[model samples]
Target: MAKHYRGREETPKTAETPRLAVRYYPKAGKLQLLKRWKDREGNYQVGPGVTLDAEDLQLAAEALELIEEFVGSLGRGGRP
Candidate 1:
């Protein structure tokens, strides 16, 4: 019988947040966002990543708001 090592004997596992990959496609004239982990799995994933312009502020603003709101919510749930 194969002995399975329990949690205490098992090797430690390290967790990391997947990174976001951004690149500018010269031929398509656009910026793309790729999942670092997903890109490693297969080759058929075609993408026209998220498009952006030099003057585009909407995406930046929205990202900021989402982060702020998340942090603000955490603060509200804790006691002084």
Candidate 2:
């Protein structure tokens, strides 16, 4: 079985919602953004996630920045 290490998690205010986490897989030397939530039995489960490589980091950051700008503009009533 492959071993993975969990890093920081961004948890939701409600328990019913899935939390996002940053995980590392040493064997693959990769970072992933994954969701973790509880099942009906109260056991934690891992859901499908995005694997980000070195090349994708900058692109993802820029995309998120644009999203942030758009969201911010909404409050200011400005065009994004």
Candidate 3:
């Protein structure tokens, strides 16, 4: 059997950016959310942001979408 990283780690949305990272933990049988940010020194940091255990991939995906939209609205000086 081939070892698959997707079952064990977060999937980066892009090679150039870390906008929305997601991972499925086989052990936990749940979907995880990853978030990224930069510090005052301009160094990047990444960490686990959230975990959804309702067993609904669609719900988790929808939540992420709403979050992205809210952030975008905030950037435009609008209500999130």
Candidate 4:
């Protein structure tokens, strides 16, 4: 089994809310984006997520910038 460490919760968890968190896998020495959601029984269940490599950090940051620009272009009413 691979050893891993979960970081602080980035988002609040609610019955209808999914969670996003950062996780580190020591064996792989990589960081990953983890998503969790509640099941019918109210148990937190892990969902599929993406593993970010060191080289992809800049690309990820650029994507966020693009998203911010796109959202800004939407204006106050969000109709664009």
The candidate, 2 or 3, that scores higher on TM-score is 2
- lDDT tens digits by residue: candidate 3, 1-80: 22233443543332224555565565545556768777799877767567655345455788767767877898776676
User: What is the model-wide C-alpha lDDT for candidate 1?
Assistant: 0.45
Whole-model lDDT for model 2 versus the true structure? 0.58
RMSD of each: 18.7, 8.5, 8.0, 7.9
Residue 7, candidate 1: alpha-carbon lDDT:
29
lDDT of 2 by residue, 29-72 (tens): 45676788878999878767876454444558886677567778
TM-score of 4: 0.42
**TM-score result, candidate 3:** 0.37
TM-score of each: 0.25, 0.42, 0.37, 0.42
lDDT of 1 by residue, 1-80 (tens): 22232224333322223455555534333344555444565543434334443234345788657646776787776632
Clashes of each: 0, 0, 0, 0
Residue 8 of model 1, lDDT score: 45
Off by over 4 Å in 2: 1-18, 25-29, 56-80
lDDT of candidates 1 onward, in order:
0.45, 0.58, 0.58, 0.59
Stretches of candidate 4 off by over 4 Å are 1-18, 55-80
In terms of lDDT, the poorest run of 10 residues in model 2 is 7-16
